[model samples]
Target: MIRQYDLVERVKSYYPAVDESLLNRAYVYAMKMHGSQKRASGDPYFSHPLEVAGILTDLKLDPATIVTALLHDTIEDTEATHEEIARLFGEEIAQLVDGVTKLTRLELTNEDSKQAENFRKLILAVAKDVRVLLVKLADRLHNMRTLEHIRKPESRRRIAQETMDLYAPLAGRMGMQGFRDQLEDLAFAELNPEARDAVKSRLDLKQEKSRDLVVRIADEIKRRLAAVGIEAWVSGRTKTAYSIWKKMERKSIALEQLSDIYGFRVVVDSVDDCYRALGILHGAWPMVPGRFKDYISTPKGNNYRSIHTTVVGPERERVEMQIRTLEMHEVDEFGVAAHWFYKDYVENGSKKSVSASDELVAPFRWLREVVEMLEHDATSEEFLEHTKLEMFQDQVFCFTPKGRLIALPRGATPIDFAYAVHTDIGDRCVGAMVNGRHMALRSELQNGDEVEIMATGQQVPPLSWDDIVVTGKARAAIRAHRRRAEREQYVRLGRGIVEASLRTEGLPVDEAALEVVVHDLPASTLESLFEQVGRATLNVETVVRAMLVHFTPEKKSRRPKIKGAKVAAGSERAREDGTLPRGRPDAIPITGAGVGTSVTLSPVSLPIPGDRIVGIMQPGKGVEVYRIDSPALAAYDDDLDCWIAVKWDIDADEHRQFPARIALVLANAPGVLGEVATVAGKHGANIENLTTTDRKPDVYEMTVDIGVESAQHLERLLTGLRGLKSVSSAKRVYG
Candidate 1:
């Protein structure tokens, strides 16, 4: 264990005016609180926090961070309380300790939810004070270092997977490459021990065979740069086993085929020297095409800056090199910690303000967005989904019309860009322009493209928009809108059913009576009761029957039956041949069709304005519309009392098109798809989408979505498709 005096001296080495007395007090408190506790490694439990503090010292973090690292586990494992820590240390340290404690105490039912819920709390906590995250990362790093001592293999694997999925990516996003690399390697060792060991053995053999290769390369780079009068420090090393294995797997190549496994870094005194050093290195070797990137000019969202290039150098070997200024080097290695090195610390026992400056806080914009998302009405599973989408994708930086930069995932669409701008914009977006040219709303955004969103005043978003967007914000917003719309639709249908049912019973539904009935039920409001009825949770007949029993106990009434238009069996139905249909005064019109609707010949064998449609009233659920012979109608035969009569509106426009789905089994041969397309076109059918799958060596199955004028038109198209020699089967798929 590190001595208290030695720890204080280490802090003073970087922060000479750090609060030494406070540090001493915290050290003693942690040691005393954790008395008699032993780690899985059989060492004093105090040694864990001590080692965590030692790790943060290497990052040169603020004194408060170092202190919090010492006490992060106290409230969770020891008898210490947050209030006591506050009284002794201060509120800042107490708050940080509370945050870490909450993270530690998360108990979830399964691993997936556990990981997501833990990250949810982590984001919320870190949004207030970034130092809390820094301290927790250090804590996780130390725990991983001692993970081998844990007895159970399953427990170790779970911890390693979580570290790889959560902590490592977070550290990388924060620009802490050193921490990210170490965490990944440690986790990889447990998750894939054989693969890791094999890669390590290969690396060890390479290192032994080329004992002086790294030194020779570093010396040669130094000698060349010195000749150019550019003072620089050049260092080289082999990539980590995890990174090497990942590269090989990603490229589908053997280890020997990898050329950039050996890498070098050149740190200089000034930004000018960084470019100058790059020029000298390139001048001395042949540059590799498509392998150069200038992150210095266009830094990553994490604020990482460097110039990377691959070149054939020193013995004609392909090598990777990164050049940056000394300041950039420090910031790249230590990330946010380097920023605190120059800040003034609190003195005289006064507390420092927790708020950070805009520049210092800018890199955490994604974190703030996540916090905002938590406020939305999303379930734990949904929260996890969006957060994972936000965390685990490479970014493409684009510009708004006004030159504002918006960073998004590589495959994000314009809808995602709109959501990134603001939620309102995304909800109302109708179209977009990319780089001043109108493009499809689902078009993938490219780096540096200027996006312009065209939004309308409409409040409801399209349900299909969910499939077009890739970002979490856009998907979440679309889902929220759809949920609200579905609720309203259900409520409307439920109200109509209840009102009609009451009229049949010769009773009036008044607000007072409705309120009384709602109060007697499980619902909190009249609207909620109606919503329940619409959702089929509460049977409309039951509510009406209950209402009659309460409002008119002396009168016995018969249940209302749905009246249907009487038609002779096998009578000529409304045909889609553009002929006028015989009018029935008793027919009820379907919603969306105006009065005096006429049944038209449907172009496809699909639901058309003139189909034999009926409405099925569910108990609490409103009504579901289905064709008379449809497969869905078979599901509700047990509840025949809920069935209602419905018909096509005669006033529906004849020019409107309806979609139809068709399945075709065809002989596997060239020109078969073309022949099907030709047949569809000849019948005036528009193919909207088509998917082909191989069912056998010589046969294929195809599903096609086509738009047609009427059911007759669709029948003609299906007949035409069946006439083709390549097509073995053709039929309309009914829902």
Candidate 2:
């Protein structure tokens, strides 16, 4: 364990202006608070915080961060209070300590929820001040180092998994590669010890066999750079065990097949010298094909900048190399800590401050994005899902038409790009062009591709966009819109059902009376009650029955005569022609004589030319509509009690698309699939999806989802398929 004075002296070395008395007070306070406690390793509990503080000192963080490391666990494990810490160290350090304390008191039901909630809190804390993350990372590092002493395999595994899943990635995102590698290796050992041990053994053997190869390559690189009049330092090392194993698994190759496991770094004095060193090295050796990335021109979101390349070197061995300036190297290793180091140096008047923007260099922007996501209403599971998608995927850089750069995760589509640009743009996007040509909205973006989104003020977001977009922001926005739309649809359906029920009971459709009754129910508003009924959570019949008990019926003689609902002109013409109405209506409008009341056409058997098809309200689900004799009606036998009467409006449009499923049995031979597709295409049917269920000696069963203009259009497609000699049978699947 590092002694108190030694730790203070280390911090003072980098930041001489740090308050020595504050450091002494924090050290003594933490030690006293944890006096009689012992860690799982059978050592003084204070030793853990002391070690964590020592780790932060190595990072050369600000004084408050080091102090935060010392007192992070006091409020959680001891009698120490936040008020006392504030009184002693001031509110900044106190808040930092409070933020670092693990969220253990949340009463979540499952372990996943609890873990997600804890992470959510940690992110919110880090968004306020990034040092909270720095200190928390150091605290976790010490715990991981001592994890083996816990003695409980399950506890150890859980901690290791959390570290691997959350903390390690966070460190990497902060550009702390050294910290990330250590955390990952330690966690990998506990999570999959056998695999880790195997990789380690292989690495050891390789290192032993290549004893002088790394040194020889480093020396040769140094010599080459010197010959070019470039002052540089070269170093080499074997990749970490976790990294090697991950690459092998990702590529599905054996350990021996890994060619770039040996890596070399060339550190130069300036950015210009870094590129100059790279040119010299590439000229000296044969470069591996497709093994170069120029991150210096376009740095990573974490601000990692280096020139990475693979080249055949001195011994004809394939080696990976990274070239960067000394400053970039420092940032790559220490991340945000390097900024503090530079800041401190500038304050001491020993060096000039770099011109990088603090916002671009800090990790808080990403942290704030996560914190903003929490403001939207999403389930714990959903929040975790989106956050993992945001944090874990590799990134691809794209460009706007005007050349502005936008970085997104791999497999992200234009929807994600639009959202990344602005929320309004995503909401208004109607189409997109990739590389100056129109493409599908779901087309995945590639690196360096320029995208131009076409927007329209009148367009609402497509319901299918939720699946096409991969980013959390786009998904959250899409889901929010869908939820609002669904609620509106439910409210409309519920109102129709209530009015139809009232009309059937010979009761007056009084909106005022219904509002009074709805106020007494579980719902807070009349619209909410209708929405509940439409979603089938509240049964329409139950609400009608409740209202009937509260309402008094008017005298029969005084009641006004209700007018008969009119059928659409097209339906009337079809009835006169003795033909059934086979086309779907653009809008299914309900009609009745009473204001705000819908009347159901009686003897609701099969839908006739004059009969209207309306939906039945189901709880949680919005509605289910089916024509009588349809296959879907069979499934609703159990929901017969919830059915309500509905009708089509006279002004309903004739042109509208509806989903239809068709199954076909085709001859299991060449050209049969194409023949069936041709038959459907000849009838103007758009095939959305196709799947084969079973294959026999002579026949195959297949299902296709087709979009049709109406029942008549679907029937025409079915007839065309039935006419094909290759199709054994074709029929509409209504369920």
Candidate 3:
């Protein structure tokens, strides 16, 4: 464990203006508060905080951060309170300590939910002052280093998983590659020891076989840079076991097939020298195709900048390397910890302190976005899942027409692009123009692609967008659009229910009673009260009961009735859910949020009279009806609140023909497709679309979309196709 004088002197070594007395007081206070408390490691609890402070000192953080690390666990684990910390240290250090402290007292049902809630709080705290994150990361790093001391295997695995899932990615996002690698490797060892051992054994065997390979590669790179008169320092090392295992899992390859396991980092004097050195290496070696990325020109959201490339070097090895300036390398390694930066453009190379610039604050913008998203800014249950996925996903940066950059996931579409721009833009998105040409809204975006959104107010979000969009924000926006659009219908329906209840009570329909009820119930306004009633989340008799106290008694023609709590549910009939042919004025409209047109069955989902169905709102196409069990509904699992609850109102629409698609594998003989078409036509099904692909010399695959009356008709057609001698396989397709 680090002693008091040593910790204080270490902070003063870099930050000379540090307060020695403050550090001494904090150290002693932490020690006194944690008296006789022992860690699972059987060490005094004070040693943990001491080690955390030592870790932060290596990062060269501010005095407040180092001091906050020393006392981070006090408010949570010991008798020391936030007020006491504030009284001893300043409010800044106290707040930092509070932010680093976890909310252990929350009554969450399970470990996962508790973990999510804790992470949510951590992000909010980090958003305020990044020093909180610095202190917390150091705290977690120390805990992970001593994780083996945790006796329970379950506890160890849980902590290790949390570190791998959240902390490691966060460190990488903040550009702390060194910290991220160490955290990941330690966590990987705990979580998957067998895989870790397997990777480590392979790495060791390779190292033993060619121990001097990395040294030779570094020397060759240094010599190549020097030949062009560019000064550089090249260092090489093998990747961590966790990193290699991750690559193996991602590429589905074994350790033997994996190339580019070794990496080199080249640090140069200036940006010009960095690029010049990159040119010299590429000119001397054959550059590997599709393996170059220029983060130097376009820095990451975390302000990470470097040029990464792979080349078949003089040793004929697939070697990966990164070229960056000394400053860039420092930021890449230390991230936000390196406070004083931007010495390049300053005259005479005098450094200026800028601890609160865009470079420092940009990475935390993601945390801010996350906080905004958690409050139903998007979907609720899937929000945490998407949040975790975003932490692990590599980002692809694209540009808007106005030159603003928008970063999204690798397979993100134009809809994802629109949402990344703004939620309103996503909701109103109609189409997009990629690189000055019209493209489909579901087009996958690539890095550096200039995209332009074509939006109109009349266009509400399409439910099909849930399938194509990859961002959580876009999914949330899509779900919110339907709920927002339903507010008016809910209000209207609720008003009728309220008026009916009033009529049953022999009272006149009046808005005056709503004011009393709104205050009496869980509603902020009369409209919300009506909305709750319409959605059945609030009972109508409850609304009337609140009004009875304030209502003036009028003459009643009928007095005796059933008890208020036991009103008959089947008696209430609004008849406003149908929209067939406009002949019946009392029919229920069955209208969805933005869907006013006639409902149509999707060609892909093929929902029929006998199948359970839902209405998914689509732009221009009304609510697209889909079967309840379709695979395409998987994306809408989080968006189910937006689905219009649908039921079969008729046996079948006589005039409507539902299109269903089916696939077939058949012997590629003379007339297989023609015979299949004839068989389908005989069953009263019309082939709307047919496409065939040659599978082999003697076999073929074909897809056909046919208009049928119901699932029965489609099933019959499939049966006939299977009976054919040439057809080997025939199956109906949904989704």
Which segments of candidate 2 are over 4 A away from where they belong? 102-110, 340-362, 498-519, 525-527, 540-615, 629-641, 649-654, 659-734
Q: Write the per-residue lDDT of candidate 1 for residues 1-735, one digit (tens) a residue.
A: 888888998999998879898899999999999999999999999999999999999988778878998998899998899999999999989998998888777643346766677677778777887777888789889999999999998888888888888889888877788999999999999999999999999999988998998899889999999998988899899999999999899899999888888999999888898889889989999999988888787777677889999999997878899999988898789877666543554779875553342454435766777777776666666777887777678778889988888888889999999999999999888899999999998899988899999999975677788888888888878887766766776666556656656655566667677776776777898777777876767776677766766776334333322234322121233122211122111223455422111122223224655556655555444555555556554555455455554565443455556677889999988999999999998988899998875578899897898887667788899999999999899998853
lDDT of each: 0.77, 0.76, 0.75
Can you tell me which runs of candidate 1 are displaced by over 4 Å? 107-110, 340-360, 428-445, 450-468, 502-517, 525-527, 542-607, 617-623, 629-635, 640-735
Q: Order of candidates by TM-score, top first?
A: 2, 1, 3
Q: Pick by lDDT: which candidate is best?
A: 1
Residue-level error in angstroms, candidate 1, position 327:
3.0
Please estimate how well model 2 matches the true structure, expressed as its whole-model Cα lDDT. Answer: 0.76
* TM agreement with the true structure for every prediction: 0.82, 0.82, 0.76
lDDT of 3: 0.75
The CA lDDT at 131 in model 3 is: 79
C-alpha lDDT of residue 309 in model 2: 94
What tens-digit string does per-residue lDDT give for candidate 2 at 288-390?
9988888888788777889999999889999899999988998899887676542435556577543222555645466667667776676666677777878
Please list the Cα RMSD from the true structure of every candidate, rounded to 1 decimal place: 6.7, 7.1, 9.6
Backbone clashes in model 2, listed as residue pairs: 535-618, 535-619, 535-620, 536-618, 536-619, 537-619
